[model samples]
Target chain A: MTKKNSEAWKKKYEESGLRDADFSSISGRLLEPLYTWEDLAGSDPETRLGWPGDYPYTRGVHPSMYRGKLWTMRQFAGMGTPDQTNERYRFLLDKGQTGLSVAFDNPTLYGLDSDHPLAAGEVGKTGVAVDTLADMERLFAGIPLDRVSTSMTINAPAAWIFAMFLANAENHGIPFARLQGTLQNDILKEYIAQKEWIFPPEPHLRLITDLMVFCRDHVPQWNTISISGYHIREAGSTAAQELAFTLADGFCYVEHALKAGMDIDEFAPRLSFFFNSHLDFFEEIAKLRAARRIWARHMKKRYKAKSPRSWLCRFHVQTAGCSLTAQQPEINVVRTALEALAGVLGGCQSLHTNSMDEALALPSEKAVEIALRTQQINAFESGVATVIDPLGGSYYVERLTRDLEEEAERYFKRIDALGGVVRAIEQGFFQREITRAAYEYQMGLSRRKKILVGVNEFVNTGRRLEIPVLEIDESIERDQIRRLAEIKERRDNQAVRGRLEALRKAAAGSENLIPPLLEAARVHAALGEISEALVKVFGEYREQPFY
Target chain B: MAEQRIKVIIAKPGLDGHDRGAKVVARALVEAGMEVVYLGLQQTPESIVRAAVEEDADVVGISILSGAHMTHFRRIKELMDGQGLGDRLLTGGGIIPTKDQAKLKEIGVEKVFGPGDDLQEIIDYIRHWRAAQAR
Candidate 1:
């Protein structure tokens, strides 16, 4: 009957000239018209979905998912210098933000300093720039280190950045045991999608494992990693691919730690996930629901994680930036609002809405606030958060969630066939899948099958109203470079070199690189210097371009 | 002798690692029957200019997402001028706002392909510009 309904819908679509119309995106995942128990044949809904916070917990993670506590209203924001980022931090905190998430500038992401030769023209151009302990100190200026959970979005030099963060907090009267926040120390996503990497994979994995072990020992409040699918979706992956590949990356990280002799309960409790809520409304929600079920089942059955906290697959969701259009920029606000609503309905732990103006540039302060308010309205006004997984029992939603789960499971089998994430990454499996998805999405858009409101349909002509944009001063780069040089002149060169050499020794040996890194950051050895030592020891990573 | 196809070097010239645009543009050029050499991220203007010369590319295309287009394009232009390769075709593609696009043209960037600009249009522009120069 559902098949017949889908066929009828397809027929109606065809009769309405959707065949000639651009039905590529809207029609890609052909849905069956009316789903019944037959659509969920051979499946026990109760056992599969279970009760809230139960095993194979497809219904919802928490017994009181949002009724107990509303999701974290954390929007990813940071730009210009660390000082500039601090001002934004205080602004967000004052405006009811509950978390502190830092976005490192491009040079910082690549383990380069503001003064490095390659960093010359790019310091503080993309995100916030942090070079040394002082820069990290200034970034947190007046904010209390122990009070807020700070998440730093840095890879490659995640160890160095986390080290500086630890040093800064220690100086600010916070103990290691009190550290709370997440570091996006997921290197798989870097190699797979974001491409901000320094050392080769093996050594990089070692550093990541070190962070996991050290944090497990010291910072119990800290989430040591957020295996990110946000970038995978940003790189244009299908929902199934994003779900499968991200969890696969998580599984690989677990296996790495497990092999390093860490207990499943010790580290798994702090593991967190990050996802992208794309413009496809029901599909994005279904992806999140399916992800929770998949992660929960995998942990229980495969790893035998003893703790319920380990079973709880908490994730932060960001509305898709790739979905925003440059042609009709304002409509992106509506698109982001819908996507944010899906995140809420999908039971995301935290949400970040993309500003409408993001396709053209970094959002203006007003645009970012509006994006935040979009989430706020959904929370306080829309009243969607009052219910946990409100759409869970809907036959349509439940089936879609199952369909996404099965499809993602198929992808998992294929990755397993390819011998897991590392082999697949080396073989460029993730890269190939995402590139194909990106191509297909663009093809849909170009064929005029996907109606991007401001771009293709319901056009707004004669609107020359200029929105205020974030104008970056070119002098920021020069200023940053000069500051880096001054820091270079003051720091003891021999001490810095000594710490870096010790870092390299640790890297080349069996020792975890974090302690040496913290020591290096304490002495003001720049992030770039620490990375350069590892690069010398491990060599620079060069990825082969995909054909 | 067979006519040598137009060669284009598409480079991602800055710190932004979002290469979907760069990769898509590279594929478009390949589909257009051009020999395209894609120099991936963290490329200095020196590296780009050198690659253009080494590949003997007829056109050099720079894709920026780090929003440092003004400084990056200026550096490329300066390097091109100093190396006496100013006559070589230069173009850029990315999220160039209208105001910045205008300023970029003023700074001697041959053409600017902002978001949603057609790949076919770019190929046509490069062809027509080269033809006009020949005339």
Candidate 2:
């Protein structure tokens, strides 16, 4: 566009009486109201975007994309007893859901058992309670282990839970090579955002590397670490911060494995990602596209990864829970649908659309069904999946994608200068950035600078929330405790003690910890017991006040 | 003579990992000229009360987003009363329903804030509660 035309456009916008706003992306980056080819001026599309399934996979990781296979509709569901969550899993799968994402309860996430004092009233409240191999078996009861892919959103005790899963699979006669799933084993994000960490960073990395090596040899189809930005975003980080911090964490893992004398190609292909699909339509899409480009480029160039599979940044997208509001909860459906669509358009391999009522409580069955149906409609009816990188080469998308890439590159340099992610996390850099961003966003809402439907605007104070909010019966904790007590009574006490002692010894020295952890799980060692054994050696991590 | 600042112990008293609300509230309290001691995640009620007693806090704010508010708050209230600290204000804010919040208030919780409750209003409530306690 000519300078005169641009000036005329600006004058027209000004004279139209539209209020001057921040015009920024949710990350506080100023967004141009319009974009032209001049924005992407000298960039060559062939070299930058290229075709799908190629190096620097900006467009997509798959050549055929969704035309070959629709993105997996994995709804993250769990609550109440193991039987209840098992029923929900079968229900979701019966409704044509392709995969299962397990959301463990708070106790499980913190490596505590349902019978622990701190677990009072919390057992099976947030998600399924799996304290031992028996609970894990019941959690997936009747679900064919080999036929389905399961993603466990457990971090701190991921290895323990993973061992329990493997034990459960072995009981079902499924080979380790046949097991396919992702572990939210990204403990760095725990330190930075989720705060579910047990041991300090160094030992946590040790546990993660053990899982990585074990999975690389045994569970070849498994994604050992889904380096996640989902919690980072839920902790109120901006899109750029989420992208940069997540990739930086991924780089740290790769560097760790390399230092341990592992080939990049052997494990890089199994390293997956989980990202948040937020409400900003263009920005979220751009973030995903930029994420793929950043991962592929860095893997091929920086890490010198040799294989094409190693360069893929395969990810699962969950529609942002932080964007869902407690007020006028139903409209969250629209928000989720749009975000899921962005995920599909941005070429996500799988997606989990959150329930509308999640901001209030654990999702009711009806709410979860609606969430699953949101993805169903997007994939089958929206006609969006038939095309690969449908938004490729669009002026705004390309410009924003490139801009986000550049911003993330800048963050990478800063993080490297801060001595990488672990040091940055210990120094509370990530926490500080996210806290400031969250505060600024809250301030924007209060100042009327941001318009959230049914919140601070549209004025829905009178409307009652009509949807059912699932309430966990307190009996769930009682039942879980009783079951745990039974397991403790019935299990071979000598064997359990022996295995736990072995695990503690393994933790004390430099050993691959998963084998001992698996042995403990095989002997009916509780999750909390395994975590405590390690805690005895590594101690617990307590964060200093950052705000 | 030195003026005393209101000491508020902000804590997460459950296995819940969400601390965005707690941190934001702590920062607001600090900016409002209160001495805020933030006890980070996975804190049990015993530990929280211990911190409250050790810190000599005028108020204890427990932030729970894990839907365990009823059990946690009741246990904490009982523990605080058992420890002869019933005069202190015990309050919190998160995903608690209005009806449950009212029940908690009836059960000895001083105030239970929910979503979109004004930050200034929280500041004012804490200050007013401390002033009333001073009397």
Candidate 3:
């Protein structure tokens, strides 16, 4: 864009009534009504974007991209017992799901057995409950672990759950090398946003590093840690915060691995990211582009990673669950489609379109099918995926991408000044920032500055939602506890005791915890038992006072 | 006689980590001059009821978005009764269906606020309830 052309465009924009209207992105970033060559006056294509598959991959990490193969349509579906979720998984796969994303129930996520008092009423409520290798076997019943890529949204006890998964695969005679999946072993994000941390940050990071090293050696195809901004965004972070904080956490993990004497190139390639695709269309696309570019540059320049594969920032995206409104719930389908489109446009390797009933309850099978079909339509009918980086060079998009990058860099500096992400987390820096953003956003809605269609405006009353809300029977808790009790009765208690003893010793020392975890899982030690063993050594984390 | 400031305990009594609604409602209560004791994420019903009794709360609002509202609310109700804090108003809001909300109210929940309900309504309800208690 030339100076003269930019000046002419600005003059035209000023003259136009449309340009005079108030404008801002969803994150409150100012948006120009008209963008021109002047917006990119400083942007050099090669330096800024490079090519789709090249260094500093602003466009995408893959050259052919979606043209060669469509993004993996992974619908995150899990609720009730393992048998029920197993059925849901098969249904989704039968309905053209390219991959599986498991949503563990609160009990499983908290590393508690279904029989625990704290786990009462929560077993398999939010997601599938897996208390032991037996539940894992049932959860993946008849589904081949080697054939499909699975992403489990679990933290805190991710190593223990993953141990169960490996044991399940071995029982099924599937080689560990053949297993392909991602573990949401992102404890940093747990402390920062989700509030699901078990141990303090240091020990949690040790567990993560252990998983990374173990996966690097055995399950080479597995993504050991999915550095997640999805939960951060869901926790009310702005787009820039999500980008900056998630990348910072990724860098923290990289630094941890390096400190543990692991070669960056050996493990970095397996590092994956999960981001939220919110309502902001262009901003999300720009955020994804900026994310890839920042990651590639940092890996090459800052970390000095030797492998070109290490420079690729492969990511999965799920449509924002927070955006699904309870009022006029059917319209959430449209919102999800748009968000999914943005994710696809932004070059996600895998995507999950949130179901319409998400705001009300767990997605019904019909809702899940629609969510899956939304991705299929985008891939087959929309023709948007026919080319790589389809919206790469647009003046508006490029300007937005550059702006997002700059904002994220500013945040990176802020995080660094606060003494890196971990210290920032300890100081409640991330929580405060996210809380303020959430409060402001809520205030915006109340003040009518932001119209949420059916929520703030276009008001509908006396409307009954006829859509089926999936009811999780309370009997699930009883069933789960009974099963857990049976497992405890049947498993070799002596072997379990020995493994837990060894686990306690390892936890006391600085040992890679995966081997002990695997041994315990093999002995059919319950998730809570193994987690309790570690908690004995590494005391549990209680959040520093943050309102 | 000087009026006591209304004490409230905002509780998350389930596994669901979605606390946006709870935090928003807590902010409203705080703005309304109520002292709030926030029981953070993944709290059990017994813990919530214990907090309510310990905080000497006028209201015990248990926010649960997960579908286990029936179990949690019922459990909390039982604990509240056992703890002899039945006078403390039990109220909450989430993705709960109107039918379930009715059932919950029938089972002794004071009021059930659904999604997008006016925060002022919550404040007004709590204040009104507190006044009735005093009377």
- Model 2 spans with C-alpha error above 4 angstroms: B1-5, B54-56, B127-135
Listed in order, the DockQ scores are 0.57, 0.62, 0.54
Q: What digit string (tens of lDDT, one per residue) describes model 1 on residues B28-111?
A: 778778888988877888999998878878888888878878878999888887877788888988877768888888879857
lDDT of 1: 0.84
- Tens digits of per-residue lDDT, candidate 1, A68-122, equal 8888888788788777888988988988888888888888999988877777667
How would the docking of model 3 be graded?
A: medium
| Model 2 residue A151 distance off true place after TM-score fit, in angstroms | 0.6
* Superposed Cα RMSD, model 2: 2.0
Tens-place lDDT digits, model 2, residues A1-547: 5878978988997788856566887778888878987788899999899899887889899888999989999999898888999999999999999999999999999999898888888889889999899988898999988989999999999999999999989888999999888998999999989989898899999888888999988999999999999999988899999999999999999999999889999999999999999988999999999999999999999999999999999999999998888888899999999999999998999999998988778889899999999999999898998889999999999999999899899999999999999999988999999999888887777677877888778866666666777878888889989999999999999999999999899888888988998899998999999888889999988888656
Residue range B1-135, candidate 3, lDDT tens digits: 866889988878766777777887788788879999888887788788878887788888878877778888998899888898877888998888767877987889858876656677788999899889889
Candidate 3 wrong stretches, greater than 4 Å: A1-22, B1-5, B82-84, B128-135
**Which pairs, if any, clash in model 3?**
A1-A37
Over A286-371, each residue of candidate 3 has an lDDT whose tens digit, in order, gives: 99999999999899999999899999999999999989888888999999999999999999999999999888888899998888
Worst 10 residues of 1 chain A by lDDT: A18-27
